[model samples]
Target: MLPREKYIQISLEINLFYQRIMKEHMLLIETHLPSVETALITEADSLKISMEQILSETVILANGNISEESIESHSIVTPFTLPCEEITSKLTGATINTNITMAELKLEAGTPSCTPWLEMEIDDINRRTLNLLDVIISYKKKLMEWVLNCKVFLMIYPEMLEHLIREARLYKRILNCLLDRKLPEFTLCEELDFWNNIMGEHAEFIDGMLDPTEKDLKEKARGFIARFERLVEECIKTAEKLIIQESLVATEDLRDYEIDATIGLLECKIRSVIPPILADHVLREAYHYILILNHK
Candidate 1:
């Protein structure tokens, strides 16, 4: 069984990272929809707001409850996160809570322990997050089906919708594991396979969204896609420490690329429909993967 403190720490840390991410996914969907799609846009906006409220709660709960290693991993908030949110909020005409980012930045890592009441609070938060994810996951699937059937046109890609669903499911799974007071039921190679596929899809999405004139950037994105695809294949074929190491290296490289791309997007030096916050979001995921692989 997982220790109480460890459980609370993991629950808060995961929520802090993923709630913000899921909210941004909603914002992207909301902003990209046509004005005529009022119902869809409102649903997305409502989900986004729900996620924001949960994230705010998480930040308050996690202020002194997170681990130093997790904070140092840069998986929660990178230096570019604030600027990316600021610029993306302006461009998308959506409100992003930069205060959350600021508060996260000020978070002080605490010892590996918590009070019993805090543990109970985290338990409640996890349950609430699980319910929210269910709604958002259903919404994402509905959107994907509509797009696939050609019943609606969205500026967002169908694959992007699918990607959002996968992430929400992953978040739900993690919360369920923590709530159960058990470790995640994933082998190292299985975990690698999941994140590797996510990274590959991110590259594909970036490649598809980039302007045709940006040949060099597109080429780099393709390279990452191919590299991660190969890693995923290796993961399927074998469970080895070497594969984890390779994945770590690849993720580090991709993290750097994402950082550069995010900066370019913020500086208006890159041409793409990708939001700056989206770039930073992918970067944070890569960083999160790196932390896991490094632990292995």
Candidate 2:
């Protein structure tokens, strides 16, 4: 067992580390992440709306020019007829050929070829579009692989640290009880040692949570949860034992002070001290953390 002063010092250091992690997590959520997500969503939505509107307009224009009615009429094509039926057949053919050639020339004159500059501009736009898509894909991957992973860890670790601190303080109180000659009923040497070992194991798990290079993290987290459940069970058993011991003390030959004192201590343990150490909130939070890990 560590000396009281040494334990207090270690507790203070761990708390400071926890504070730092909390600050970083706050900064990420409050400032950095939200701003980036908002900007990306806004820009992507605007671009999508604009492209959809343009596509709709293009479809409408195309339908107007190539309607079913126009297609049917165009399909009923026939050879041209000369106005003078009495004219020679050779003259009619020459006249028809001349008009057809003139029309073809006129059509050719009206059409324009694509300029080099326009082609270059289109190529540049395509290249930039591809680059932008690549960048967005890369960003998404990194956000998932790094940012989101880190966020889950950051969110979970501080909470884990908080529980560890509580357990540490609980252990310290148990140590105090061991040392104090007055409260022997609260002092079971073997039970205290067992709980201390559990606390130590929990401390090690917390250290792993804060570690950047821990392997098989989710597996370890599951193990921690199993151990935590056992710890809770042990704590409940301890509480039951304390209650039974106090209740079994026969009232015969006992002063009023002694009876009152016993009751007072029992009430304190059940109502106040034990509640904080073996909290429902902690269990719920630990389970919630596990869910988050599984989700990620």
Candidate 3:
């Protein structure tokens, strides 16, 4: 079984990062829908608000409960997060919870021990997160089905909907393992396969969303797509430490690319339908994958 302190730290850190990501996913869906699709748009908005509320709770819980490593990982909130959110909210005319981001920025690492009260709070947060994941996962699937069946037209791709669902499912699995007081059961190769594929899909989305005139950026995105595809193949073939090292290098490169892209988007130097927050979103995920690969 995992130690109580470790569990509490991991749970809060995970929620702090992923709850924000999931809410941004909802924001993307909400913004991409046509004005005529009021019902779907409203549902997406409500879901986004729910996720933001949960994230706010997580920020409060995590203030002094998480590790210093997580704070330094740049996976929870990048330097770009605040500026990106500010710009994106203004551009999209959407209400983003910069307050939560501000709170997260103030979080300090605590002693490596969990009090009984803290443990109870972590348990409650975990339960709430799991329930929220269920709703969002089902909603993502519904959107996927609707898009596939041509019942609705969304500016977002069907594959993107599937990608969001996969992320939520991964978060669900991690939270469940925490709730069970056990470590996650994934092997190195399994972890590589999951995150490498996610990285590849992110590259694909960036490529597809970029303006046709931005040939250089598009080509760069395609290169990342191919690179991650090859990494995934290696993951399927072997679980060697070499693969982990190689993945780390590739992920670092990708993270740099994401950072540049995010900067470009924030500075109005990139042409795309991709929001600045989405750019920062993918950048954070790449950084998260890098941390996982390094730990492996």
Tens-digit per-residue lDDT, 74-116, candidate 3: 9999999999999988998888989988888888998745689
Which 10 consecutive residues of model 1 have the lowest summed lDDT?
233-242
CA RMSD, predictions in order: 1.2, 36.5, 1.1
lDDT for position 182 in model 1: 84
Candidate lDDT scores, in order, read: 0.88, 0.30, 0.90
- Name the lDDT of candidate 1: 0.88
Clashes of 2: 0
Tens digit of per-residue lDDT, candidate 2, span 97-176 = 22321221222111112344433332333233333334433433334454445642222334433443444344334334
Choose the strongest candidate by lDDT.
3
Q: Can you give the lDDT of residue 187 in candidate 2?
A: 41
TM-score of each: 0.97, 0.20, 0.97
Candidate 1 residue-wise lDDT, 1-296, digit = tens? 88888898888888888988899899999889988999999999999999888888888889778899889988899999999999988887888879889989888998745688888889888999899999999998889889899887889778788888888988888888888898778876678889999999999999999999999999999999999999988876755877988888888899888888998998899999898888999999999988888878
